[model samples]
Target: MYKSQIKIISVIIIALFGFILFSQDLEANSMPSLDYSIELQHDGSGIVTEKRQMHLTEGTEVYIVFDQLEGSEITDVFVSDYDEPFTYQENWDINASREAKTGKYSLIPTDEGYEISWGIGEYGDHEYTVRYTISGMVRQLKDGQSMLWRLFQGRNNLPPKKFSITVTGPKYFDPELTKIWGFGYDGEIYLEDGQLVSWSNQPLTGRNHITVYMQFLDQPFQPTLSWDQTLAEQNHQALENNSYQNEDDTTDIVAVILLCSFLGIGVLIVILASIYTAKRNKAIRAANPLITGIKRTEMNEGKVYREIPYSEGNILDVAYLLQEHGKGDMEAYFNAFLLKWLKEGYIVQLNTNEANGDKLKLTVQLLDSNTPELEQQFFDILLSAADRYGVVDTSDVTRWAEKNYDKITELKASLPYESKRTLIDRGYLYNEDVYFLGNFRAEVTKSSYQGEDLYNRLIQFENYLNELLSLDRVNLQQQNINEDIIIWASLYNLVEPFVEKFQEVEPAYFVTHHFNYSNIYLLSLYSSGFSSGYDQAVTSHQTSMGSGGTTSFGGGGGSFGGGGGGVR
Candidate 1:
């Protein structure tokens, strides 16, 4: 009886093992893949050629879905299996038997989206190339142009084992200016050979889709579809909790040391305190004049003005002075506003936790304060950039600036004129005749007698701030250096150097004083980050593909296109 039972068990094990091997063989043979090449025309139309390697058994047809087109339409669809191309059937019977539907395709328009269906054509393993043209694939945004598309849906019944997408536009995609991001599947996307290419790394299973978002600084195609709003900000926000967020590579060495230390707890506390001091000193050293890349105005030492130029100490007036005479760029204008806001309690900087890895991170809160009557609009714009919690961060500012580019540009263009108007009202500016071509002339706004005197005073004040970098602690103390003077120095791009000098003299200046050295540093960092990072972040797009790390086998929200197909 025991021998008979053993023989039966052996037979059952062999059968199960053979079945497992057979299933693996079947899966290996049946695995499918897709490659998409999209060529975008000058008028934003797209010619998409999908090369699919699929294994078919007794199935009658295969199909692809397109939805959320936003008035876009698909046309000129052709399907081939490297043999005779398939014929278009006016009314494709999806329920037809495999033999009846051979060498035929059709476009079925549903209320939700369109399905492009094609026959199997006696396939075991077949390479099918399906071509289609989509009108208005790219859209004109309020600030720029963008293309947001989902090549396929996550809920695809037979998701491809692998997929590749290559997109080419009317113009070469400049790597520095063109932004591309992929969502919904584990893959890599990059600009190469004047085009954008993306591919999947893993075989997609339950709810794995492919969505792509692309933007161009210089429009590569003239878009026909128009959306009267920017898509970048919302797209960026969608990627915040995704893998695209900046990764923290630093390990907690201190924690490891504490865990392994045989020393007393007091020693650990002392070590922590020393680390704190070293970090503070490091931040101060980082504030060195040479490290602050902003160029300062060079002035004659003898003409250094020790007094403030404008009694009111308006940042706008200082901005005007810098724009008219000093080496101030758009950054300087932003810095001037930031510093002024920081000093007058219009904006308050919050302390960030270093242990949380947000060291030197800048965050500000917009307070309810009455702004300057002349600059009320500017303040309102600033407020518009803040979040629901009244907090302002780099991302918030970047998004606001990108979306309101025209509004901000118009406001900034009016600054010089507004400052001049204020000066004229105060009897410091006048319209004067200027010569052109030695025959014609135009009356231009210029400094009057009083304005010229005030300009000299402003130059002298800037010179004084420049000299502070060279002065010793004792000599620096002699100069009337107040918050107002420091804030005004930002106009001349001297605030960074001033911070470095102050750090050198009084190491505890930030600690003991109500003054915000951090505000200056943070705003400067914000400005630099904005110029580069903002363009990259706020102008890009995203979809909910993964949850911060692992693959999200759910749905892809915030993307176009829906549904997917398999051999039916």
Candidate 2:
């Protein structure tokens, strides 16, 4: 009887061990996979609707990752627009659940990078795109959005994040008809039917919630360092102690040889020689003019020699020349460089991998698309810089560019576009082209409002300029050849009485002309798609209450982003 009982116990124990090993292997090789295909349809302008649902019974709302979907556009063909907007069209407004109810961003948190979504479409197919142009490499929804976020621990360390969440279509999605999309990240996922409702426990690197998200692991969440040095040191100490306790007292033969090598005369001589040579080369390179940048390139290369015009006092000219030459002085921009470039048309690179511990690449191109001429200019510059120092494909130029671009872009966050734009209007970019530029500059003393409140009161002044630009638009509609007469009059501070005629036709608040310069607001917004959301994404940074009651927001608010907020 005793022998029979022992045999039964042994079989049970073996089965349990086998089952444990199988489960361990299964866990080591699995992750959640998404299964929907994306579709983009055009025409059939009757109207279209987009609906989103939250499936978790306890959860009130959910967030979708955006920015990754660059190059794609969304359109609200026609939706029911109630008295109040139903869909949160602007990204700035937080998502509010009508049912359970609470306003919160579609993206609450994330281990890294935001997961944003928007109802995108073509403006007759021309409303610029932000998509997966760099899908696998250098993550960013588009230009301004960063894919550079990092986490300290494993994935799922933080909650999900979102940016530019849009739900356009007032008449149709005015109040939004809701539905549940899927269960929360914690619901059980049944692979057999593919109907799994499981919470996404994937903590991204850099967050501390990995322990809470990953439930099945018997061990604690590992530190995000990928390899924790402190823990490693502790483990190594324990190992050494154990080895000491179980070993022979004498040192091993291999250890003796390594010890002698650490103090050997021959090794010491080699170390000294290498250090001396490195220092000598460093000194020589510093004094050599050929190693500097532009001047050196001109002396060595013979294919082309176009000297950039430089300016003396103005900083704008210096910035423009540095960007063009591909190799030159790199410290001449304040918020001035980037703001000017973005408004006109330029894209700067901020990727770290491309920034070889150097400057940034401030690439300026048309916002519409890349032209062949532009491509040639870029490649030519890139190739020239590489050749100048035998950095040939070492990625030195691009590295410098990416860092420089990133710094300027971040700087733009604090600058106002008014002063920046005016500087360009008067022709400051040419100052540096002369000595730096071909000699670009405009007298600030002769500029509007002088430098007293150049930045603080720029938007209002810009409004005036826009109105002047509007005079040109009238020439487009009515062959009024006297267009220059009206424009010149406005520039010289004499258009007050001339603009009163436009008050009756514009929206109530937009009327009632104030200063000699501001009627430019409406004209500017109309051309730039700034006044309203009907045709284009108009941005006005300053919140204003004008004649009838126009509440203007985002008026060139000093180098702000397009994916900043919702438009009216």
Candidate 3:
């Protein structure tokens, strides 16, 4: 009888242990994603909305921290799961019952900043959308307007699997006069349709926070709080080691003009300028016509380059060059490679029953075409995600990427290296070792051409493609479209616009070209879907413990917010 009882107890213990292991495994595999949107008001306030889709294994609540918020007020805090609004609790209890904590939130003030906390309802998966208004978000500097803010805090265990931030400035915001820079992570931040959009190229982990600095040269705001320093001075000090400086520095230009004026040499300066302008025009006129034949506009001068820089550049080469210049990212590389393969007959997109307006999910089937040496690994990864029928879909790609996050990250990190090596071999780039006072040695990569002519040519190529979109149907049809151009368009995140333009001008273009899509919408869907899947996969199952590549002190210095919080 004793033996039988012990056997039953051991079986029960074994089953419980198995269950515990299973739960831990599930939680380990699942991850959360956050999407944040901030709209800046003319009054210098910002309305921030955080949409967090979380997978919770434990903890009854989660919270966000808003620290370093002196002179700033956090108000109108609201949290909901789209089903019902959470009631505001003046005093939030951390140890409350799941039933008691459900549909409740609290705003607690800390010595540093405010803590916005909400109940997690029951565990598993939950979508929590939190909204709050931050007063004094955009400050008025003595010389210009400035906004230095942190979107996410580093060292928070709850690192988002996939995250994106969309910051919409005032309607009258001018991209030309406003200079923006991003810090604290490896990502690309740029102005899109007058809005500043930023996203993580790789998964955010460890000390990788999100912070932005926007300097408005036109002084567009009338905020109550004022800073003593000029925005330019503050920007210079903040962006000491950061790389994403997109604006041209006019300090030297202004100084040179002032000195020439003070010296009463205006006529001499004008003659020199004219002579230089004449030479520039002569060089431009002597250049061969681009394949697109898009005429360069004045706006393209300095801001946009209208020609391909290198003679034997491919999509990967261009993607690498743009990335080195902070104008491209992993998303560009991912989309470009996928589309390039499809165009080269290595894969075929099959329409599925799924449809969303003009967009449709595409099932990709591997073709018998020989894959290029540079593309073989990526192709093999896609094949690994394929079903027994030798087909892969968007979902499959996402799943495979999630399961093989390290592989994808390593592959992406290798692309730039490979492209750079190719360029170096071609004499476009070379390494030069520099010594600091004849003691320490550092090898700095140098471009062969003066004033980054190769990079400018890429910009020109991009400008040409952009100009093509605005052309009339007749003019558009007169231009030739090729696989390389399409791949570069994907890198530029203009595939959708290009597809729309093609569809509007000549729907027959897709049928005639190597695009292999009967419906132009399907091509657009695949491009978007592939990008989305790749992002979702890379972000999943990534821990907050990263390799410590934090640049928090660089551009994000003196930024408001950036305290850390998680499930507690």
Candidate 4:
């Protein structure tokens, strides 16, 4: 009805539309990116691999154009069929580190966009293949093998990626490859055979990804064998062919397996119970070690200890040992250390006062006395004992002081205990304990506390202003899934391979891929193992002594060590 009003409204509408368009363009251009990286460490044990997130936009694509995969043999390709927050990216770029004798892959752009020409052509002994496409995963088969495949709806949104894979292994056995599906971005798929697992949540975005993996073959021969030989060697049936088939033997074998399974479950229960008991305590490690000469922030000792327990005192204590090994200083490192050891229940607090009369004062407490040098000495002593007694190095005789010495030395050292007992022969925590552990190869000296001969306790003190006005309790949320169950799953995953990698029923391969989506991401432009892939001095580790080589096999074994290769 009114021309002026109508004209004004129209102008506003036009401006609003333009703003919306501009915002969308900005979002598309600067969206978070994912880089798909596959790392392979060459310790004869096998590949220790990982993936990465790269810088990307809605329409941007990265291609991994590798000219060579340098190792004694490409035993297995490290790929995961995970989805959301993590899907695999395609490899691109064609320059060789060495020669022009090798060329990059060819490309053919297509209709909807450019269809990446992948895994089709062979470049050389060195090759490039589209391991898997991240963005366009349209059809996931129903066999349920992808590590990124989800079973719950809210976990992740399917990004519709796809690939038709055809792998003909130099086979001793080949199972009819099955179709895997029913993927929940944050759930599991339970088949009569195996299951897929994950640890993240997602409503996957435009450039986000998920990953799935194939099975692995553990036959020592498969890495170099053509397929049939690998199968023949892997499918060895000595036990099946044995002449020991008494009905009694069948009964005995069944009985033995049952007994072992029951025993295993019992052990698992004990471990789970122990860990649960450990975590539920909600205790920060003993923080008897005091902070000296700091006047910045009034550090909540509990929070600081939970995150970084090592002291920055003038005295050279465990904190200094950590510094020697690259853990940061009192300002940076101790805080983090405390956070991990928070539930360990070992910290203590010293007295506090005011600095500027308005600010808070602080006193120094000494907690950890073990130094890095001490830990090494413990190891050295163990090796000397091993050499003297003629015990195999495999025994690691010096490392086993758990319930006994663990409580005496490590536990006491972890607290505000005055001194480690000097009586080594009477089992008092002493230089003798170190001597005994070092001699027997039993770890008498726990890692950080292995050496405590470094402090004079002449540390100074300072006043720190408390940052928080209120020392509120931190609300640490519990994971919904029983951590015990997850640990069981992870441990089994880390252990069950011997059986799976050796079984010879049909054509088969199994791959176990896990995503540790903690805030701890692979930070450096971090390439591993030097040349083609990446490897760094592993900053983190599995805590227990029982790592890779402790499994007991039934019969005699062949010499199975292989030479580790260098990057060309």
Candidate 5:
């Protein structure tokens, strides 16, 4: 009887070990899945509802966390097990260890996010559902409404098995002009059943986020055509009448006599004066023909080859040029300087690789020494702003701007004065201020002296470069730099050839990774017309979101969906 009992005990222990291993394997292979749906209205408000499911073993407790959304009021929180309601523990201590908990479930609030805990009574697998409502998700625009949805926040450890978001709106809503941006992941937006705009991602893992932006037009666009026969007839008659002219030949003999008498006296005076002046000029020219010819040549050259006296092949010059043209835009300024630096060999492109279908990575090195004072200053500022890794990536330009925001602001503030000083030194300006008096003149002229209108400055710079390079303005316009990439390349290509004509050969150096010249190229292109369109879009979007602006959902400091569960 003792031997049989030992045999049964051993078999039971073996079965328990096998069951434990199987449960561990199952937990490792499975993850929770989530689904979200948001219903929006035209008045800048919306509701967000979601459902999630996960599997757990018996006695294992799971915690569901919710991340707070910015500019949103969350309410109507509900949690349940499948279709059944689960009771929550009151007065639960969040600081207590997970193993110390004796309750079946608890909802505890924390600084980072809310935690919902549940103990599994008996489970091979289980599913839980959560739902919440978010108000003020949409922003009111002048003509319509806009919404920005951040799809990935508050997610940790729970690698989504599948995730989807659907946004439904009124029947008049159009999804064609919707804009979507994804970080660390890619997603697609499309119309569903003509009224809903849906965005979806599946099997997401490892910290990913997405943003969806949509603008709804207040009214549907309708084209109309109407022609007025009577108006056309009137226009034709007006054109015919204006095309004809009548000549008046009536003469006044006394007036003609007076006019001829004055004209003859003027001619006699001019002839006498011309003869006297010619004789004096002949004597002066005969005395110094070489000097006269040199003076004349200099005057003609000044008209034909008017050079922009300021330095052109450096970063500061580009900044000055940009400000002069009223561009004052930081990205365009950086892009212009980047082109100059690349051409002057201050920055060298070392290697290139395709990062993805739409992205390119370039390795670059910054050469030390031998740059202009201003260029070196700008270069050092950039070097100082490098990441902790001691290297700069082309993609980090925006980050660089953010990290050195104060310096950048100071640089922008001093740029106008520096630009004026450079111009004054070059004799472009007589002084800091040029004044014009009118009957109703008041205050200062901010546009010209204060660097307000950058577009005008750009035109002036363009004209200056055209004359300096002896380029045909008509031909340059015909090349259409905006549409022709070859022409665009050729225009900037002038920088290197011009510099090489004057500078010494030097080893090129600058450090960079994933630097794509196209980014800089596109930036320079903005100097033409694209920048205006970008500004308009940004302005419109900002105006729609109101003064405080629409906040990014997952960017808040508090935890909304940051807490998760672990298997025990």
Candidate 6:
């Protein structure tokens, strides 16, 4: 009885082991096989042909996904079986409820690539041939044309049994000059009668894809300069006409001489008036202790001199203050604004734990609740979204800009329009209309402004800020007052006398002290009360497939089509 019981247990264990081995064999057989080929052209185009074979179970359906080449215009896509042709669609969602109805196969376009699904009637063996033409596959190098051909990066779900590629180009192409690199499988390339051919028959295990980089020996084709030559000839004729006019216009030349003399006299009068006004203002400022007190208080407190009756709410106000103080250094004023904000607790520096001597490795973060609306707009809409943790890291800002490009563009387009409307509503501008009598009468209108020179200067200041924001953070962070010192001096000429006096009082301290303090003030004001990064951050969150040319694929038991697939 004991021997019989042991025999029964042994038979059960043997049967279980056999079943596991059979299942593994079935999984291996289910993977699809691919055979691919391509023909190249000198004008950076290619015609690709692929033959695929897939094995399906009794109730399973197979979908073949193909990755479209980047920057290439694909056309003439065709899919066929041994007996009949397959129907295809472009840019179709695979998850959508659709049916081939009667056909054996159907092809659909996806964001990353294309998908081809076919029903296996008997679940034995199925074969399909796909063909397509791609234009602009070759990239232009400095001296010649190069092509980076990638395969097996996409459609990894359907593993290929054998893959082959043949590149046929111009006779001038030399295989010796062509360099190739393989990613997944080691492949061989040989020049056969002036044509470059490559093939691989290894199993794609522990590999992503294969990339072949080929540089042609021949120089890139260049068209003759017929249009440029014509343009040069036209420019020469214009110069000849100008020379002829110079010889003929004696009366016009005399009129020019008179105009120049009058202009020179006007310039001299303006310069004399400017010199007189400067001396007079200097005398007045020297006598007035109130103005002197304000400058002294700003230097001591490291904030905008609120006692001067200049608005301190917006960047425009800062520009007005600088202009009124006879200081043209926007950079200095901006630095002062930063310092003020820091003092007000709008922005705080978070110290890094990493040690780098006494040099501050600090990231700026918004802190206070009393940020001005304009500053809040800049902080929430621009700066905060740049860093993940609301810390203003320059590198993070660049990465954020790349990911949220649409938000950047929308802000750029809308800000100027909104500013214009605000200025108009504030009585800074009036609409001027002009009527033109053409084939059809029409009216053209534009904003006409009154003589508020400060308002115009404020507009220019805003333009400068926009230009700064548009720059990459690397360039923006490198900006310092010394680079544009001449422009700053002109802008701050009103405050130059006071600044000189302050410099004399503390000869070595003025430049470093003022600049550093001002920067802190500006940052604090800019980031105050803004927790969210960009105003459009919420709206910008959506699905994205990323930039690679590869598509992804997955198989669900019920339906063959769903999910995207691509090649690298």
Compute each candidate's TM-score over C-alphas: 0.48, 0.17, 0.43, 0.19, 0.34, 0.33
Question: Tens-digit lDDT track for model 2 on 13-127?
Answer: 5466546544553221111222111121111111212221111223232333323222222233122111122233344333433342322222322233344333322111111
Worst 10 residues of 6 by lDDT: 552-561
Q: Residues 473-515, candidate 1, lDDT per residue (tens digit)?
A: 8887676567777767776778888898888797566675556
Q: What overall lDDT goes with each candidate model?
A: 0.66, 0.26, 0.66, 0.24, 0.43, 0.42
- Report the CA-based lDDT of candidate 6 relative to the real structure: 0.42
**Lowest summed lDDT over 10 consecutive residues: which window, candidate 4?**
532-541
Q: Per-residue alpha-carbon lDDT of model 4 for 92-168, expressed as tens digits?
A: 33333222212322232322223222121121221122233222111111222111111111111212222111122
Model 5: per-residue Cα lDDT at residue 467: 47
Model 6, span 81-188: residue lDDT tens: 664676654443434332332234455555865555554444457676767766665655444555545544422354555666666664545544443322234445
Which model scores highest in TM-score?
A: 1
- Could you tell me how far off, in angstroms, the CA of residue 505 lies in candidate 4 after the best superposition? 65
**Model 5 scores what on Cα lDDT?**
0.43
What value does the lDDT take at residue 241 in candidate 5?
Answer: 27
Which pairs of residues clash in candidate 3, taking residues 3 or more apart in a chain or in different chains? 206-544, 305-459, 305-460, 306-460, 307-460
Stretches of candidate 3 off by over 4 Å are 1-31, 241-554
Q: Summarize candidate 3's per-residue lDDT along 54-157 as a digit string, tens digits.
A: 88777777888887786888999999996579999998887887778888999998888789989878777788899999998898887788888877765644
